[model samples]
Target: MKFIYLDNASTSHPKAPGVATAIANFIEQGSYNPDRGQYSGANDTALAILDLRRRLARRFGASSPRQVIFTQNVTMSINLLLKGLFTAGDHIITTSMEHNSVMRPLNEIRAQGIRFQVVGAEKDGSILPDKIEASIDANTKAIVVTAASNVCGTVMPLREIGKIARARDLYYIIDSAQLAGVLPLKLSELEADAICFTGHKSLLGPQGTGGLILSDRLHHCRPLISGGTGSFSHSEELPGALPDRFEAGTQNLPGLIGLAAAEKWLTKQETKILKHELNLATRFISAISEIDQVRLIGRDADYCQVDNPGRIAVISLDFPDRDNADIAAALYDKYRIMTRCGLHCAPRAHKTLGTYPQGTVRFSFGWSNTVSEVEYTVSAIKDLSQR
Candidate 1:
């Protein structure tokens, strides 16, 4: 039987056309660490890294390439930014739909006298800007939120919330793990202080590659890790620079190079890919909505008809009378359809959506999925529901 992969939200499969080749070429050519050696090969590597940063800056609409700081992944980027920016007695504002990447770090910092308020999102994973605005106050230090929910792919009202943050003079940080590459992002419009993104997910790049785009307005965030940044090695203290201050130790050169190639490939085909994924999601939702046992989570099917209802190609379904995990397993075993079944690491989101203990089965479509695959999956679900 042929297999269908629909878990792009976790990590994209068959990454961009040249991603693997780029990594392979880098390895075959003898990978060199930039800023560490004085040789021409090392200098060339350094320039390549700079070029990637410049590309990312242009893509994300950052003011300068120097403001782009890379980390191992989105989780590390969020931890570094949140921990460095907050201190005792500070307050933060986030949402119930955030992934563990943001919530876990905030939970850890809470022990240090820093407190955060979660503005509850609607049952459909939609958040209101006023609710977030109401949550902010005198002690509020920053507003950190995910651009879209990983569980349901409901896009947040970032522009409105960013406006609120700017009017209040508060820092706005966004976790773009599920947003980047899936949607168009322009930093100037969002008024964000930082956007943390991972290359493995919607970016269609390999793992171990991600970074942050920082605004010039944010200056006081201290370095989370302190070590050799290939700059100011003679000094005992960390270097006081844009990227070197936050980036410590050896970098992921191979992964970064692959990500660069992936970005290049994705830039040309983003619109067509997005349209295809959305159409697949629309077909799946329409078919599954007719089944009595299937309960669609997040946005209703009507939202798909509009030009943009602020949603991605992620769909979650709950078999109220059947075991969600069992359904997922059956789909994989009997039909060769791969999916994720559980709270998806966002327990708070599950609680908000009212699927807490018995989590839903998530089918996140990707650029490569086709209408025939979606129809077959729907047919399988219908057959299983009847049985």
Candidate 2:
């Protein structure tokens, strides 16, 4: 059977051409350790990485590329914030819509005497910025949340929440795991202390290249690991700086190179990419809305002001008459359509939507997903319901 892929939220399918080309070029023709040598090849490599930083800074509206520290993925970056920024006494506020990437670290910190509060979003997966603001107290130190939920694809009220955090003098960290490439942002306007996102999703970059964009406010965030930082070679301590301070050991050279190329491609295609994804998402939900017995989660009436607007092109359809996992399994095994079911590593989010034990079938779209794919997915859903 011909396969249809609709799980971009988990990890994008068939990355952009430059993604693999750059990585392969690094392994084949561009092999040199950046910052380790003064020779031409090493220097060229250094220039490449520096260029990546510059582009990413502008991509996220960061002050400089040095503020962009490369990590394996959003998970590591989020953990870096939880472990290093929050101390035993610091109180942190998060939302029920967070992925395990953010929750696990905070949960561990909670055991170690840190205070962590999870503000709940509305039943439709919408989080009012004020809800997070109201949870803040004298002891609240930082607020960490996802830009848009991974499970339900509901965009949060970041503008209002960011203002609240700024007014209250609290650190605001946004996990843009699902929204990075699909969304546009003025990070400077958000006034975030640190913004964590991965390259694979939305950003249209390869895996193992996502990380954090930290503001100058988090100069005090301790390092989770320390190793050769290229800078300050003579000293045993980590480099007392932004990227170097957070980045330890040799960086992911090829991944960074691919990421740089991906950024260049995305910068030019940002608007087109969003419109394509939005249109596909719109077509998808419209098809699903026409299907009887299909309940779409995170339903919204509007579609503007968000990169992934209308709440969901990443639709979660609950087949109450049938087992969700069985439907998902059949969609893949028989229909050749890939989807995600169960908690999707966000049990807390699933709980918020009341889909925990029997999670809904997730069909997340991407910029490259054609409308025909949406129709195909809808057909499969209709078939499953009929069965």
Candidate 3:
């Protein structure tokens, strides 16, 4: 039986063309530790990293390539930013729809006397900038929020929130795990101090590839990790530079190469890919809406009609009486449809949506998914709902 993968929110399947080829080439050609040695291979690898940084910087609207700091994933990037930037007496403003990547780190640092307030989201998973502004206090230092909801693909009002942050002189940090590669982001226009991203999700890159694109304001923050960055070895202190200050230890050369390849492929077809995925999501939502037993979570009455530009192709389906995990398993065992069930690492989002304990079955579309596949999945769900 043919298997259908609908778990793009967790990690993108069928990565961008040439991603595997790029990784294979790097390994076959004998990859070297970038910025580690004086050898030609090391120099070339270092240049490749620089080129990737430059391209990513330009794409993300950074003033310089040095502003991009590589990390294992967005979690690490967020931790580095949050832990390094804030301390006792600091206040952080965020939203209920944030993933654990943001929430967990902030929670961990709360012991240091750094306080954070969560701005409640709408029933439809939308976060209002006004609500966020209302929560701001005299001690507010930064506003950290997700670009979009990982569970429902609800696009946050980034521009409005950014404006509030800028007007208040608060650092604006965006977790773009679900937004990067799938949506166009101009950090300069958003007035964002930093945007964290994971390449394994919408970026169509391999696992272990992610980073942070920050403005010059990051210079004020200290290094989260201090070790060999292949630069400023003579000094005991970490290099007070853009990337070197943040990136420590050996880099993931193959993963970075794959990420660069995926990024290149994504840039070439971003518009088309986004349109295709959104269209599929709309079609799926429309079809699913027709089923009497099926209820869509975190969607408004006008969701189907809204021209959701920043929204990705993620959808959550909640069965009032049925077990979500059972439904997901049935879809897999009976229809060969692969989907993610349960809280999806965002218990706060689930709690906001009132689907905390039971959770929901999520079908997240991607660039590789087709309209026919979406229609088929909808049909399968319709069949299961009737039973």
Query: Per-residue lDDT tens digits of candidate 1, residues 188-306?
Result: 88988989899999899999999999888765688778898889988988777888888899999999999999999998998888778878878888888899989999996666643
lDDT of 2 by residue, 194-246 (tens): 77889887777888888888888887888878898778888986678878898
lDDT per model vs. reference: 0.90, 0.82, 0.89
Clashes of each: 0, 2, 0
- Model 3 scores worst on lDDT over the 10 consecutive residues at 299-308
Model 2 alpha-carbon drift over 4 Å, by segment = 304-312
Please give the distance, in angstroms, between residue 100's alpha carbon in candidate 1 and its true position after superposition: 1.0
Candidates 2 and 3: which is better by TM-score? 3
By TM-score, how accurate is candidate 2? Answer: 0.96
lDDT of 3 by residue, 1-387 (tens): 888999999999999999999999999997998877889999988998899999899889988899989999999989989999998999999999999999999999999999999999988899888899999999999999999999988889898999999999999999999998876788888889998999899899999999999888777887778899889989988688878888888888899999999988888998888778878887888788888898988763345332456456889999887899999999999999999999999999999988999999999988889878988898898888888
Which RMSD values do the candidates have, in order? 1.2, 1.5, 1.4
Off by over 4 Å in 1: 305-307
lDDT of 1: 0.90
Instruction: Please estimate how well model 3 matches the true structure, expressed as its whole-model Cα lDDT.
Output: 0.89
In terms of lDDT, model 2 sits at 0.82
